[model samples]
Target: MSAGAVADWLGVACLVAGGLLSLAAGIGVLRFPDVLDRMHAATKPQVLGVLLMLAGVALRLRTTSDIGMIVLVAVFQLTTAPVAAQMIGRAAYRSGRVDRSLLDVDELAEER
Candidate 1:
């Protein structure tokens, strides 16, 4: 009917989509059967989901402070999530918990 109504609907939809993506990521973590797959799902989708949620909230609020906070949060997530995921992957690798079926074997050991 009105632009406001449409915007509200869109905001709600964004939040719902974010929620669903987050749920999917969680399910992927539980269902993927390996750490590599879990990382693949958790890192990307979680970042996207958080961004979507911030977008929805920012759009719904439509205030300068809210927008600023949303931007800060999105930036924080964009920066930290990848670093965290990389750390987890590296930790897993150093500790020898990888999916060998999906990749080439480590040759360093053989060379040594």
Candidate 2:
């Protein structure tokens, strides 16, 4: 087997894994009992799935500009996802949408 074939196979694998993770994340967001749990589902696996998909695209493209674009996308995703999730979680908490019973420690409650 050639190196190119191996790379293609790896790329396909990454794409498939990423797709599955993304699907799971979507399902979790829909199925989780609370806002916090839904937020967790939206951010964690979704970010990883996006990164994996980018990796697969980079591997398949194998061009400098393409890889650079992918890196930029990855950077933006890493920077934005956590911040977005935190904001959403905070908003939910502030609106009393979060289920306090599910949290082991409600540090934010002390501030209230």
Candidate 3:
């Protein structure tokens, strides 16, 4: 088999895996009971899924500019998802939308 064929197969695999993860993330966001749980579902798997999709695209495109753009997208996703999740979680906690019983450890509660 040629290197191109191998790359194509890997790219396809990444795309499929990413799609599945994204789907799971969507289902989680819908099914989870609370704001914190939904935020976890929305940020964690979603970011990884986006990165995987970008990797697949980069592999298929194989151009400098295309790969560069993909890297930028991945970086932005990694940087923003966690921050957004933190902010949302904090807001939910402050607004009393988070269920205290669902949390194993309540570090934020100590401040109150």
Give the TM-score of each candidate: 0.89, 0.96, 0.95
CA displacement after TM-score superposition, residue 91 of candidate 3 (Å): 0.4
Worst ten in a row by lDDT for model 3: 103-112
Best-to-worst order by lDDT is 2, 3, 1
**lDDT of every model, 2 decimals:** 0.86, 0.93, 0.90
Query: Which pairs of residues clash in candidate 2, taking residues 3 or more apart in a chain or in different chains?
Result: none
lDDT of 3 by residue, 6-111 (tens): 8988999899989999999999999998898899899989888888888888878899999999988888889988999989989999999988987899998967
Candidate with the larger lDDT of 1 and 3: 3
lDDT of 1: 0.86
Alpha carbon deviation, residue 51, candidate 3 (Å): 0.8
- Order by TM-score, highest first: 2, 3, 1
User: Which prediction has more favorable TM-score, 2 or 3?
Assistant: 2
lDDT of 2 by residue, 1-112 (tens): 9988888889889999999999999999999988888999999999999999999998798899999999999999999999999999899999999879878999888774
The positional error of residue 59 in candidate 1, measured at the CA in angstroms, is: 1.3
- lDDT tens digits, residues 1-112, model 1? 9988888889999999999999999999999977878999999997899889988998699889889989999999999998999899878877889865567766434463
Candidate that would win on TM-score: 2
Where's the lowest-lDDT run of ten residues in candidate 1? 103-112
